[model samples]
Target: MARNAGKRTSTKLVFLLSCAGLLGAALIADFLWASSSSHSHAYASIASNWVLEKSGTVVVPNKEKAEAVKSKNNSVDARILSGTFADLPGPELKWEKMAPAPVPRLDGSAVQIKNLLYVFAGYGTIDYVHSHVDIYNFSDNKWVGKLDMPKEMAHSHLGMVTDGRYVYVVSGQYGPQCRGPTSRTFVLDTETKQWQRMPPLPVPRYAPATQLWKGRLHVMGGSKEDRHEPALDHWSIAVEDGKALEKEWRTEIPIPRGGPHRACIVADDRLMVIGGQEGDFMPKPGSPIFKCSRRHEVVYSDVYMLDDEMKWKTLPPMPKPNSHIEFAWILVNNSILISGGTTEKNPITKKMILVGEVLRFDLNTMKWSVYGRMPYRIKTTLAGFWDGWLYFTSGQRDRGPENPQPRKVVGEMWRTKIHL
Candidate 1:
């Protein structure tokens, strides 16, 4: 674990205060920055000190440091579970483990289009990022197809979203761990299974908050490579049918916070940004290769929304901070429900704590609540909503600073029933 784990621990994890109560509402009469969370910038299941290289062992960490982690106390999670989960107005929820991925993964993203679930680029082991795509058939409950992303596509720290049959993948770290980012953008058409290159992002970033807003694709807040610089730049472009209508991206309102690994969503016609951290690692200066940041990372619970006037307003903070949950959210029954990501680090242990609550933000109450409890804690989880089931899969498991899950990186999919 890195330093500053207690108060300023890095959000090397994902966001809705770590994402999604994902309800977009405001009791905040004040214009405020939105909350967000994110995945640790495409890291494998290891501590922050180990460096991932392009040709070296990216998935495996240094053995000496890896061994040191085992000596830590394995106390069960000290965080309390909500007694109010049962009180939430929904049907009973039960979780079941589905078939695991053919390969393990972390810091990945997924999209559900029609009956197929598309699992896209991520690190297979730390050595390199996978450009491959895996498609799971909901009807068959199995992985039915596999393909590859464009060579120009980003490997990790990606900003992605779906509009109809097209998936827009935006700027992100292009190479292996902690490397420089790419300004390129690509769109994948699920129906045709083809990719089209769009005008590149004007500014490159890591895990930026990308969303499809009214008539344009909006991208905001990521980090500057080589330091923990939180980028506030917002850019957009006009697009139609998976093709860029504009030759270049246009500038928009800069986000108030460092928007890496956060969730940006539109609900009830309001645009919101939620739960992400500033500062990942400060890489050693002037190294052509990669190592680690000299500083620690910090996760937060701030939240903001864009009002009808096209300006931002502050919403209430989540009860606790969450990270590594960039896509772990779904809209159901007018509420934003998010699940499974990292929270704060244990004060004494200084190790990261994975979240176990199934959190909800109600548009009706304009409030956040624990709607359910997780089967276990996980991070970098991809989520989806289909029929009446809440589904999540693919993330790194905490190896028990408290209760651990599968002990390492995983590919298992889990779902719980929660009818509207």
Candidate 2:
């Protein structure tokens, strides 16, 4: 009886020890799994793994697929063909509606100073040229009426830049009718709400590309008086005390192919010229002012960069021939984000077909990629970036194929949080 009791005690002790060991192993496995899951979520959030599929759609892979790609050779093509590219979840670009403007406007010049956005002259209802200056308070997110521009300064297609305290308004058209270009320039002190006329541009032009770089105003290609002849001329002038100096403008290397409504941005101390149209507004044949035999217009996809030495170098052309002149662009994360331009015009209808696609160009790789498409077609809008967000003001929308003048003006305002 004593031997049987001792045997039973030993058996019970063995069972307890085995149970403890299994529990300890299970706890370690759970801890490791939790840590790995947290790390994966963090990595997926920061990585640029979202790709545009060949079907003109954007796809974001799930965590399982993302991890699988990371574990393999990391070839995007291979992962895409692995039969897991359908409906995978990922980060997406989000757009939010903002306060609308008081009136619908287009082709205006916009500049930001601190928490204020100053919108200059633009075309309003019935194509009426507006001289009123509409100010938007970033804090309040509302439009506040301000002083009107001088009667002479009331024009659209103007170029504008700001130095945080003052805004410099450059050349644009004058009066309601699309008549001729104006060399007039003006400066406004935001604090005083006062306006002062500055030295005029050397040549009369409208829709010129202007930038304030290193205390100087760099003016690039624009259209001449006829609107048909695009100028290849580039000039720079010294700006002092919120006024352009009396010194003559210095001429730089001319653009290879001058374009009207071109976009110029200062990136990494280099001036980049985006898409523009070569021949626009050329008078049709049998008109009183027909100067050239060729009246057809050509939109260019070519890009050029200007360095500090005043040398011009050509860069790779964009994938698509985008030429919606006077479009808006913003620089984010060392990449240029261009939105709402025209890819081409209808050959027979002569109507401008808006390019609904959004594109991004990486400065590091010198490559262009399609980011996504806008919810609706937008063109000739004023865009600016503030507080890591992009604001797009009033612009024109496509009125479909039935309308004669298919471009319909709108007063919608939109904003989006920029992630890349």
Candidate 3:
């Protein structure tokens, strides 16, 4: 009985020891696994060298070499930065070419209504003012000709907006020359395909940024005669029953500073103005033109927002100074996407350089970031957004960086899928 008791005790001791050994091994393995997993997660968040390419692949370059290159160059390429640093968390964007517009044009205004897009007057191929109103049906993907806008009402550098049924155009140059600013305002009934003149703007200006807000048309700063003389007057007109009921322009708070080529839109019930040129750009010195100075055109990077109380507040400026007379922009998901525009103009040649970089501003954060580059450099184009896609129509393209003359206009159209 003693021998049997000793054997039983020994076996019990061995079994307990074996169980303890297995538990110890498991605990060590679990600790190592957890440590490795946490290390990988931490590395991913701080990986500033990685970039999300258009193919949706994350690329990590040599950290030391990339930093060296960035230091040598004054500006860093935002596209090569890591996903976390770039804040590009959305799906990959794909740009696809669409049907070309019927005629090549620039500095045109486009508004989308239902399944159709209406393109208004612009500069034509012969450098002549055009009154063509081209209707593009998104459903059929074709351009259908509409009745031309009245010859007197035809002009470029105008402010245009739509209240669903009626399109309002205000303040533009009556002729192709620089000294033809007009205060005439016209409204086009989309159903009637006819135009009716409304009360003229209180001030004669060209390219004033306009938007329809709370059943009123708000027109902001623009150029008075030449690009240098900017008008700071801001005015609004109330509309009722699809017509301008208030014939007199009601004065609102004037813009703090005036600028030409300003782009305005209403986002989150606030009026926002984007890029423009603040002052006149004179010819460089020693040029053939007498009395010329070396004053270069000043493109603005500043952004301003008007609150409900008609108070203006400056927000973070754009990534760079831009003064492109015409560009495409759309408000989606409380964010504004500004596409291709001109960033600089040669003081001597007066040639403009088109920037292909696409910029996005988050309303919640009030910060701007580069989204990506467009497929091609474009400016003075008509753009509209619908059904998760942005459509860009005819615009002028830059020939080259060395070219001294304005590039030819292109009638090509393109569409890009944007995932908010």
lDDT of 3 by residue, 297-391 (tens): 56778888987887899999988776654447877888888877666553212334466656789888988887776666667667778788878
TM-score of each: 0.77, 0.72, 0.72
RMSD of 1: 18.6
Q: Which lDDT tens digits does candidate 2 get at residues 294-317?
A: 344677788988887877898988
Cα deviation of 38, candidate 3, in Å: 66
RMSD to the hidden true structure, all candidates: 18.6, 21.9, 21.1
The model with the greater lDDT, 1 or 3, is 1
Over 4 Å off in model 2, which ranges? 1-93, 282-295, 324-327, 400-405
List the candidate numbers ranked by lDDT, top first: 1, 3, 2
The candidate maximizing TM-score is 1
Quick one: best lDDT, which candidate?
Answer: 1
Any idea what lDDT model 3 has? 0.70
